[model samples]
Target: MKTVVIGFLGSILDSGGGPGRWEKWRPSVSICQHDDLVIDRFEMLHSRGHIRLAEQLRTDIASVSPETKVNLHVCDPANPWDFQEVYGCLHEFARQYPFDLERERYLIHITTGTHVAQICMFLLTEARYFPAVLLQTSPPRKQGSGDAGAYSLIDLDLSRYNQIGARFAREKQESTEFLKSGIKTRNAAFNQMIARIERVAVRSKAPLMLNGPTGAGKSTLARRIYELKKSRHQIQGEFVEVNCATLRGDAALSTLFGHVKGAFTGALSDRAGLLRKAHGGVVFLDEIGELGIDEQTMLLKAIEEKRFSPMGSDKEVESDFQLIAGTNRDLRLAVAEGKFRDDLLARINLWVFELPALRDRREDVEPNIDYELDRFARDNDVTVRFNAEARKEYQRFATSPAAVWSGNFRELSASIMRMATLAEGGRITTDVVEDEIERLQSTWRPKPSQSNLESLLPAKALAEIDLFDRLQLDVVIEMCRSCATMAEAGRKLFAASRTRRRAVNDSDRLKKYLARFNLDWAALKH
Candidate 1:
């Protein structure tokens, strides 16, 4: 197999006085002198002006290593420092050069070019333009020491370095685990979501919107993202959290964008609000869809410009922060209703992650139970664990279809805390588990109006519908009952279809579907 070394002819470094040139360590010549690194061929690139120098270096290389063949190629960029021209020239050369990977190995010599040229070589090699490794040669430490200098090979292929690739995989796993709060969650979808969130949390400073049902850990995940960024030194400030649902009217504006003295009748002094307080850090706006339109406008400005005018103050205060917005309500529906600014939604919708409800991820319930118990132990200094039979019994009930888990992780955490508190010694026995199950069942029990479809439809009309149609209608009716408007309910029901056919009116489509059953949105709500 042949070893080929491709490099630029360094006009200055490769030049030397006659006869005394052999004493001086020249990279182009010294490289061939290495007995171990047998170079079968040297492809030296040179400018038109360096023809003489190129020939001289070629001869010197041949004299030192008679078995080596030296070939000179003309590749001159108008401006050597220009990255585009240099990269393009080299890229063209690489494209034209015949690379025989099976029979020969190639080394890109990076010691003899402009910084831009060196960088271009590295990029091309890394990109597999030249199926080669990078060879960096350095001059000898002492002058006139007759040293041949040193050469090191840098393999651009990461797979060749098993330890490095394994390290990266390990770090990614650790990051995903960190985002999950170290719980070994078995749900594949949730694990995949966390992995993507981990990547986005570390790599992006854009606003991240977490959409999930209430108590589905949106707030908890947002805080964990902040902690991860802080741990990686990606964030230098504090994590300021605000539940937007708790803010209203003047208080909402004053609480988020700050207010000066005498901003309102009750304003007595200047106050730096949550946005300003989150400068150089992260601000989590939980239940962001609850913010009024006016508050949304100001919040949008603060996010984009990193500055906003405080109440009763013309001057704008600056606060550079990363925004993580959480909401249970569908913001798109709110936008259609003129409740949320579309532009604001567009700005914060760059990275949207929807956390699934607990009922959707039953497989994760067992692991999360252990996590909750561990948390309880840390908080109260009392360790607790369920016995084998009790653990099985509790897990069975927790993962059962009957366990709605309306409050998601919050409900699960509370259940574990309750059982742990009532456990005998350190064991949560079947008796305690059964009591907890009954308590959960009672809390999850539905009211007559919500539980019974017969309450909404006459017995004769309900009996006429097929079971499948009845089941679907029940779900749609439930959605309508929960939503504030027909449009909102339609949006929830046809969310996926609306994405595919944007022109289709969701409310109209839903209305037509309801009419098939001799029903309307208004009647379903009643």
Candidate 2:
């Protein structure tokens, strides 16, 4: 379903530079061909030789799927070109390489020379040409703190690239070219939400709880708050996030409060917890309701006393992080059932603000869609215009009761992106919208017969899948219940399972089976 390429710049020793540290750790890369591209960072190009390594990577791709097409791009520093010229060469190579040039080709920089060259690659691919095809490589582990590990590959779109560019611009006094180029700024309810938070910034020191589904701009809002405060005050801190579901037992406290060396099994060194790092900035704890009773107590103590002892340490380290908690769960229910601590809830709920889902803001749909379509067009260097029918189709789908949008903004943005990529004649059509909608749904909805598979799997597997996969899949299925033809379902199912190790051996086989089952990869993963 995706076109792929393996781009090999000459070894860093030869090419002068490749991806390095900061680029490797960020979450921005999750926006692009997350499933299809694998970033492989190496200190030096493999001794296997360029042709051999390329062939081997090709073999690896083929072994994953016979239909998987991997193209090789070799960048040589000896060719003697600056960043712009290197980018030009990349464009030229992409133009010449017909297969997988658009979607499947991955840029693998095999250089270790300097970080300058790697920064150039990131700027070209992520900041400028956001070809869905390029996947950058990560660096090897560091022997020391100063070693810039290989850069992480990112599939960046305009929004995420802008986020990074904005960060750099603010930090280094850089140009605005990267920040304001594509994104359309608007003052919506979201802006109002930010305004309200700012108004309370100094007046209220209570923990602000931002209640919303993930990607409903909660993280962005949190960052905006930190930036605004940092600009005005001398607050030296970092914005940190903790996914409550992943914070288990002692790990939760240790993550929130740093642990001394020998704190636990993996404690190689004394480290700072999120709370400590956040310091005067903000600690955004997503899925806050998932916190267990004991963790809740620890959180209350830290919030109330600004003091916490790291695991296995007698001395208490002082922390002063402003807490911005978020969750999609019903904490009231959790507290009523005694699953949540009443005192903890009392502390967190002191300044609660519920963020409405995208669907709940139907009036904002068309504007948001228009903004996204424009962004998608600019990033890909292609113009996509929505015809009347296409506009109506998208609007209708947005307002449709059938569109559950359980994942809220994240799902909607992803669907819009896919539609833009698959658009024809620069005009989005009802057909394209339908296809995307069906593709999104097919992941979760099982075929009429495979619904019987419910009778087969063990209860734990069923339960393991319930919240993560099943419910979300059902949401997509319910959106496309009116589909007259099964073509859309076929594409969704194929796209969903293609990356999975357990996927059927052949694309055709999986496609056929998905058509038989009316399901997609999202369903299986969920």
Please give the RMSD to the true structure for each candidate, in Å: 5.4, 28.8
Please provide, for model 2 over 315-432, each residue's C-alpha lDDT reduced to its tens digit, 9 standing for 90 to 100. Answer: 9888888888887655664676587888888888887776766666666666668777777877988888777987787788777776766667677778888888887777778889
Off by over 4 Å in 2: 1-195, 374-383, 424-430, 441-526
lDDT of 1 by residue, 1-526 (tens): 8999999988888888688877777888888978789999999999999999998988878888898999999999999999999999999999999999999999999999788889999999999998999999988998578788999999999778999989999998998898899999998999889999998999999999998778789888998999999999998999999999999999999999989999999999999998999999999999898899899889989998999999999999999999999987767757876778999999999999878878778999989998999999999898999999999999999999889787889999999999999998989999999999999899877675544467777789888899999888878887776554566678889988788984978788988998898876546644
C-alpha TM-score for every candidate = 0.83, 0.49
Residue 267 lDDT (model 1): 97
Off by over 4 Å in 1: 11-25, 48-56, 59-63, 66-68, 100-104, 266-268, 446-526
